[model samples]
Target: MPALPRPAAGPGSRYTARASTTRPRPARHTDVAALSRHLTTRDLWLARMLHEHRVLTTHQVASLAYTSLRSAQRRLRTLHQHAVLDSFRPLTQTGSAPEHYTLGPAGAAVLAAHAGCDLADLGWRPSHTGRIAYSPSLGHDLGVNELLARLAARSRTTPEAGLPVWLSERSCARRWGDIVRPDAYAHWRDGDQTLPFFLEYDTGSQPLSRVEAKLAGYAAFTTATSTRPALLVHTRTASRDQALRRRLAAPARELSLNIATSSADFTTSSPWGPWWSPLGPGDTRRTTLTSLAARWTPLGSAADLEPTDADTALTLPVPPLPPTPDAGT
Candidate 1:
């Protein structure tokens, strides 16, 4: 996890430009209805994904949706052309950064129409792409997406495994913000075993104490809602992971919160593999994400997963993988 490059100062810096000149964006007046005709089911799904996740890099998009990088690039470029998606490349010290994408105006329109809601209700504006492009939390957002994308990709080849449900931070906030603000919420399935957990993507920027304090909120959330989902804290380094496990162990146990900690070093190859270590007394050995459920047999089913009065079909979490017919594209 290399440090993200800081945005250069001045009006003319690369950070100021939202899109590259090589692939120009469509006009602001692009008709959403006409563009909708050309969008495949997969394209519509991608638009929904971008709307939910805030942002994803080209590589991450490929991992989640396409069979190859070349094919992903091709379709993504076309989406950009139709203003179904918007993109930006960050200023990097060495090589160029991969194109990062967000929902475009047409995309929002399509999504709103699908949900049978007004465009304003979707909470999107012309400045959405630019705002996310320059957001301070951009790296954290991308890291979260990257980890989930890897798990989703693994499910493509492994028949027994799948990431059936993935809720972005915004969705998590909507459902449980009053209790605990998790980075994301997901349901990881390996055969008959399903592990529902809330993710905390730590960049190792905040103080360890502040991070430890988050456990109290999770405890309150569990007590208030009568749901005990596992808390997974993923840090940037092995050292940071060790520090977190040490700090969170006692508090997590006292609160009866099933917590686990993992770092980027061990998860790079296979995030679903044996990288997660449970925070408790004995057998500090790491375990796979799916196998984690067995370690904590008392861990019950996830609560608050059902749709509330506020949810519409369009706003609900979509399956991480696209429909089988269009996945290869």
Candidate 2:
């Protein structure tokens, strides 16, 4: 049989068989339920993009889906046709023609469903999530942007006029020791001069040291070469406002930093009564300065005047002190 004539290999047959024999195992951890979650063909594509990329622009989706721009437009139009994704058409910066698409409520839900998870579980928290700071990825000066809008609105009717604002984060660890980049900031410039205002919405338990350092930076920044004001805005009830105002109000006469408290807008009444503090009994009470002013009168008739020493001093409910010879005199 001539050694049975070694079997000649078929053309590409051995290679093809070898390649076909080793099938890849399906992804084990994948929830089979996800396949059923997609709504339509368009929803399937959108879900794929969101799952793969975490986010996707309409242009990117068009490219990924290998569809025409018009098709992509129709896709976005359809998915959001009933405000499905909670789609919102926000204006672009100034005159920019291209508008950016962001995930809205419905889109978020669809994407989350596809991923078999909630966004909040993926590190996005609800309500006031701490404070906003420089997100290196976002790149834009979100803090400065917020500040500009506020300052523009605040001084929209003020006579002092608008000033060009300059804003920068500390950008270094050493500077972080003495400064904090609050959620937002504002800068005003009037002719070869500029002033910076930092906004802090303290909904967290920030260390006192950090707060003081921020105020110090603001004061230092405002002092040289220009006379201007640095304002810190807070919820009216925020203890931060109280602590900061007390420090800035006394002895630091040169500081341009001012803490304003009100019941409107972001403001709320203080949680504690006018007199409450852990720093000691009197610490939380109205300042002695305010107490003195509130207690004093024009030395009018004795009947018109209540007891000064007794009234001025915040007393715990107890016995009244005996009048002293010189005190009465």
Highest-lDDT candidate: 1
TM-score of each: 0.91, 0.29
Give the Cα error of residue 90 in candidate 2, in Å. Answer: 19
Q: Estimate candidate 2's RMSD in Å.
A: 27.5
Output the worst ten-in-a-row residue range by lDDT, candidate 1.
1-10
Candidate 2: segments with Cα more than 4 A from true spot: 1-182, 187-196, 224-227, 236-240, 251-329
Q: Which lDDT values do the candidates have, in the order given?
A: 0.81, 0.34
lDDT of 2 by residue, 85-193 (tens): 2122223578532222334344444445545566563333322111122123222333232323333323323424342332223211212224344544444433333
Candidate 2 local lDDT, residue 65: 40
Predicted structure 2, TM vs. truth: 0.29
Query: Which residue pairs show backbone clashes in model 2?
Result: 85-107, 163-188, 163-189, 164-188, 164-189, 165-187, 165-188
Q: What's the residue-level lDDT of 98 in candidate 2? A: 24
